[model samples]
Target: MSEQSADPAADLSDDVRLPKEQPTPAFFESKTFRLISLVLYLGGISGLGMVLALYYLIFFDSGMPDIHLKFPVSIGGQPVQKVHEYQ
Candidate 1:
């Protein structure tokens, strides 16, 4: 057998070793995880967009009637007549 080296640096190189097994796959790698994340993200974005659209439509649009006015108006405990009578 060949004589071993006494130098510390020389022996350290031989002792150093890489891991035999790889780490577990990331969350994004799994199809189920990816799909769930995508669904949640999309759902959140859609909900936010819907809320924004409704806000703009209600606040900015004058053509739409107010919520309180939607109910039938009352005059002395009797419902008011329609704006335009067909007959």
Candidate 2:
């Protein structure tokens, strides 16, 4: 059997870096994490946009290029003004 040096540092390579304990994950795991992060970031931005828009619409004025369906078709159809005949 070959004799090893009594000193622990003697076993180390020339670089002499500390051995990493944790196992490194694959590259795809990192990419998946990044994609999930991006989606959450964009979702938060869109949610904020919707809240501000509605707040402005409520407290402020209207006429913002017709969101549509403000009023549905009346069941009675065309509106007719009642004529008052008082003699």
Query: Which lDDT values do the candidates have, in the order given?
Result: 0.75, 0.70
In Å, residue 41's CA in model 2 sits off its true spot by 0.7
Encode model 2's per-residue lDDT on 1-87: one tens digit a residue: 999899988787866445695567676678888898899999999999999999998887665643224433344774244333333
TM-score per candidate, chains pooled: 0.38, 0.40
Over 4 Å off, model 1: 2-26, 61-87
Backbone clash pairs in model 1 (N, Cα, C under 3 Å; residues 3+ apart or in different chains), count: 0
Q: Once superposed on the true structure, which residue ranges of model 2 sit more than 4 Å away at CA? A: 5-10, 13-29, 61-87
- Model 1 deviation from native, Cα RMSD in Å: 11.3
Lowest lDDT 10-residue stretch of candidate 1:
78-87
Query: Best by TM-score, which number?
Result: 2
lDDT of 1 by residue, 1-87 (tens): 988888767866565446865566688798889899999999999999999999998887667655434565779977684443323
